[model samples]
Target: MSHPHGDSKRTVWYRTQFSSWMIAVGVVLAIALVVIAAINASYRTVSLVLLIAAAAFLVTGGIKVTVSAHGVTVASALVPFLRRTIPLDRIAHASARWTRPREIGGWGYRWKPGLSAVSLRQGDALWLELVRGTNFVITVDDAQTAADLVNRYLPGPGEGR
Candidate 1:
């Protein structure tokens, strides 16, 4: 969805392509697990665990990035309780750029030193520099629009590359 337009405090956007990819990955992984489990009785438990993990990853991978007057929130599907919110006041810099999964120590939710994000693809991401805590690198389809929306809400020192 481009942006959520309803009676809500914030307008949220979710990448349709990314969501589809995640779903496909989840299904394929689950099928693979089932095949592996059938090969050996001892592998059943491990296969189950792997399937569960893949399901969780798929659920959380469909991210909904909400931009409000106060800040931007990266709401997760599976792990909604651990959603990442970057307050505009706390943001020192905000920008967007082409990013890869390997750059941030793989995909999904990551926390390595001064960077973390719920990444779902290897493309342009919205990067935010906060006054405290590690910087954020999020996967968004319309990175430029998102950054502009945030700037409109709270203009500050930011750049795009």
Candidate 2:
């Protein structure tokens, strides 16, 4: 099937496991447990709840990554609710980098010290550094494919470096 936003000449979509919504649910549950435990003055319960919260964060972080495509447009996906779009011309550079959990720091459409780290595991990414200095990154299942798309559409200076 063709994605609505993809170019006519190319149509292929790639979807990968970003993260389990269960982890978010788990955080909510753990927070509730902590509140309940605190109200009931149960130290053991509170401790257990905190542990669960940590586990949820870790598990969720591990699962979360990116979904990308080359010829296909990725307008509608798991994180579409929080996704942003940047024109190819505005992209400065894109590459795959190993980002640790604390590297990006925090979740959901964020930019920390390193770069715009999509909340996904280590994978190929298409990064767009805007001419205005701001940058955006999107995770993709295939690095070479994403790069090819950037080259085809954008085709600016310092490409294929």
| Per-residue lDDT over 1-161 for candidate 1, one digit per residue giving the tens place of the 0 to 100 score | 33545533465444432466676778789888999999988999999889987776677667777666668888766555657777777776678888888987777778788888767878888888786856888877877767766656565345421
Worst 10 residues of 2 by lDDT: 63-72
Task: Tell me, by TM-score, which candidate is best.
Answer: 1
On the 0 to 100 scale, the lDDT of residue 111 in model 1 is: 79
Supply the global lDDT for candidate 2.
Answer: 0.49
Q: Please, what is the whole-model Cα lDDT of each candidate in the order they appear?
A: 0.73, 0.49
**Relative to the unseen true structure, what is the Cα RMSD of model 2?**
7.0
lDDT for each residue of candidate 2 in 91-157, tens digit (9 for 90 to 100): 6555554444355554434566546655554445555555567655555456555555454555546
What ranges in model 1 sit over 4 Å off?
Answer: 1-21, 34-41, 77-82, 155-161
Assess the local accuracy of residue 108 in candidate 1 as a C-alpha lDDT between 0 and 100.
Answer: 74
